[model samples]
Target: MTDLPHYTEYDTRLAAYAVIRDDDGRVLLALWNEGDQPRWTLPGGGVELAETVEEGAVREVLEETGYDVRLDGLLGVDSFVFSPAQRSNGSERPLKAVRVVFAATVTGGELTPEVGGTTDEARWFPLDEVRGLPRVSLVDVALGYLAAG
Candidate 1:
């Protein structure tokens, strides 16, 4: 739970995530082990100061799943508001989260778990099996974009 986002200040963050699928239509997902329990999510994280969202998505995928991937195109964006567990004031100060999702294809690398990172495991799950897994809304939203397309 220590690696989960904790807000000490109010700020808007822009993040990027990758939706990588194989020939079998199995999506690559990372198991985030920082919350109350591990949950599956698209491989992504906050974009760095000078990095483009696409580059950030590539980097996050590599860092989380050890997979090299090529960006296909921008799928869609997802946004939400939530209060961080650690807040300074007692009032509910919600952080606005804007996430950019990209359609991507794996270029290389093997499936491996991230070390000393927010994600502890990475795996490919069949599209139909994803709904049965414990996951974040990001996963559903990303998949929805693909479904709509």
Candidate 2:
């Protein structure tokens, strides 16, 4: 007789993000050094334990972009599932991510880079020019909601 181990485990992650823009139609973005290449993405990160989604978005924005923002409202929600190779065992693990997006306005603070973090720098980019830059999928999804409303 042959014996096989069977188990199914998935990680459910919750994250929050913001779509922030300026009067000149420039959108704020953060440079994330994730893999072999860095990409620009909306400012946000994983929701912390005991923190509301809105509060998480606000905190992540400040941590990644050094910008204090006032959240205008909830934009939308996005969810997806993917399998990533586990570094420890070389096995594939399913990750389901649920993201909450919000529209925000910059209240104060200067543009600065996050130190020793997933994000390296933060800057404003022209909306028209964003499509040409390397960016995360969340950027477009968030912008779609903002444009529709």
On TM-score, the candidate that comes out on top is 2
Whole-model lDDT per candidate: 0.89, 0.88
Put down candidate 2 lDDT per residue, 19-106, tens digits, no spaces: 9999998999999887458999999989999999999999999999999999999999999765565322343676778999999999
Q: On a 0 to 100 scale, what is the lDDT of residue 24 in model 1?
A: 93
Residue-level lDDT for 130 in candidate 1 = 98
Write the residue-wise lDDT of candidate 1 on 1-149 in tens digits.
47645666556789999999999989999998876779999999989999999889999999999999999999999897767554333545667789999999999998889999989899999999999999989999998999899
At residue 77, give the lDDT of candidate 1: 91
Taking the candidates one at a time, how many backbone clashes does each contain? Answer: 0, 0
- C-alpha RMSD for every candidate: 6.3, 4.6
